[model samples]
Target: MNRAVHAVRRHAVMAVGVLVLLYLFLPVAVVVAFSFNDAAGRFNFSWQGFTLDAWRHPCRVPGMCESVSTSLQVGAIATVAATILGTLLAFALARHQFRGRASTSLLVFLPMATPEVVMGASLLTLFVNVGVATGFATIVIAHILFTVSFVVVTVKARLAGFDSRLEEAAMDLYADEWQTFRRITLPLAAPGILSGALLAFALSFDDFIITNFNSGTTITFPMFVWGAAQRGVPPEVNVVGAAMFILALGCVGGAEVWRRVRAARR
Candidate 1:
């Protein structure tokens, strides 16, 4: 009786897990399926036979390419800047203990913890007060500000688990701080740093709400999608979304593979 009950429970759990996965991925599956649809209207995903029309005819959709390009540029700039600043902040937080350290940590992580609407409004207010014109540059700066928190957290977690004696040993062997950090610390922590940056890039690329608030006339992919949805999305939006999803998945997979390879080598 117990064995039968156990089997029943296991099956029940598996069924629930499958349902949850489907619930999460069903929309994405539909989007991917419809990206190849011959129809022009995005809302009509009835699959009137598969064609690469959307992928090939991206130019037919007004502002699709421009939005994509803007998203890429903004994501790239924000990711780079956030990664550098966050990594440095992580290093400082991990290596040194100082007054207001707790406050510093809270401030660093505030962006991630705060509500998105609040952060966006606050940033918009700050920009207006400072007389900063809203555009791609402002959008990029806002993305970097919000995205850096994730990087800081990821890098700091790695640093927390790191053995500090490696750096000490390097120092004992006459290596300076810069050399020790570049040669020993960074090499060991590179996986986490890279992973953090990749994660940041993905977030920045996909962001909509904050980007919309900060962006004036500059349309990122999400903004384009929003505007297009007013008139009903073009089928090409599905293509673009699917492409971005695949690219992001590949980047994350690559980072994971690299981390595992480094670990096995070590």
Candidate 2:
């Protein structure tokens, strides 16, 4: 009787997991399916017919490509800046004790816990108070601010699990501080750093509410999609979404392959 109950529970758990995955990916599936849709009107929600025109002319809608370009640029810059700063901060928090350490840790969680609308509004007010114009720079700054917390948390988790004895062994083998870090520490931590940067880029790319609050004249891809939704979304928007999904998948796949290759070599 107990064996049968256990078997039933295992099946139930697997079913729940599958349902959760379907719920999460349903929207993404819809977007990818609509990318090839030929619409009778501006709205591409319903399938009229299948066509390759949307993929061929992804930038057919004016300003769509430009907005995508802006978003890419911002995401790239923000990821770089946030990764560098957050990695350093992670090292400090993980490896050393410092004054106000508790306070600093608490502050990091505040940004992550805060509502997006509140964060956006607060940033907008700060920029206004400082006479800073709301534009591309402001957007980048805002993204970096929020993204840094996530990076710090990720990198810190990696650091926490790292074996310090490896570094000590390197030192015993006549490796100096820089050599130990370069030859041993960094390679071990690279995965976490890479993950943090990818997370930051995705957050910056898909952000809508915060971007909307701070973007005075700048149009990001998300903002462009919002504007188009009022009139009618273009099929090109679906194409862009599909492209982003594919690009991210490719990157993740490439990373996994590289990791497997390195593991096999070792």
Query: Which candidate number maximizes lDDT?
Result: 2
Q: Kindly give the stretch of ten consecutive residues in candidate 1 with the minimal lDDT sum.
A: 38-47
lDDT of 2 by residue, 197-252 (tens): 98999999999999999999999999999999999998889999999899889988
Every candidate's CA RMSD = 2.3, 1.9
Off by over 4 Å in 2: 1-9, 261-266
Which ranges in model 1 have alpha carbons more than 4 Å from their true place?
40-45, 253-266
Q: Roughly what TM-score does model 1 have, to 2 decimal places?
A: 0.90
- Each model's C-alpha lDDT? 0.89, 0.94
- Pairs that collide in candidate 2 are none
- Cα error, residue 28 of model 2, in Å, equals 1.3
Model 2 superposed RMSD (Cα)? 1.9
lDDT tens digits, residue span 1-266, model 1: 99999998879988999999999999999888888878744565466888887888877888889999999999999999999999999988888989999999999977888998888889999999999889999999999999999999999999999899999999999999999978999899998899899889889988998998899899999999889878777678899888878987897799789999999999
**Residue 52 in candidate 1 has what lDDT?**
83
Clashes of each: 0, 0
